[model samples]
Target: MNTRLQTQTAEKGPVSVIAGPWPSYASFRSLPERERWVLYGSAKAYREALEDQGLIMAEGYDDFVRRVTRELEL
Candidate 1:
């Protein structure tokens, strides 16, 4: 848990349970720092480093990114 997951209030509602591992070094490293900062916390992205998995998003994307980056201390 690199960052504390926050409750969301987007159309999809609060945070979802990803129930899997976070991205791997090889997969996560492929993204430019700018892109990595924008993962939607999708189960696919969380487990496999793939973002925008075609489902409704949870938190506001910008908010999610900002919070995650702040917490990651990057």
Candidate 2:
């Protein structure tokens, strides 16, 4: 888990920590198309986070892409 983003039951927690520094999704999303794009352009992290769920299909997708790439090159 990201230490910066972690929560314990006793503490006030991560949501308050995050909302102050960054523009929350609700605010930025209402802007014009170019305005929204410009806000997203200065990104420090991806919009979607991939979690450590221990899922198997990620390896399957890697193998599939490599196989297709090799076939296309040949």
Measured by TM-score, the strongest candidate is: 1
TM-score of 1: 0.31
- For all candidates, the clash counts are 0, 0
Candidate 1 on 1-74: residue-level lDDT in tens?
Answer: 52334456566575543423333333454566656556434423553342344233335456555655554444
**Number of clashes in model 2?**
0
What lDDT does model 2 reach?
0.36
Segments of candidate 2 deviating more than 4 angstroms: 1-23, 45-74
Model 2, residue 69: C-alpha shift (Å): 29
lDDT (CA) per prediction: 0.45, 0.36
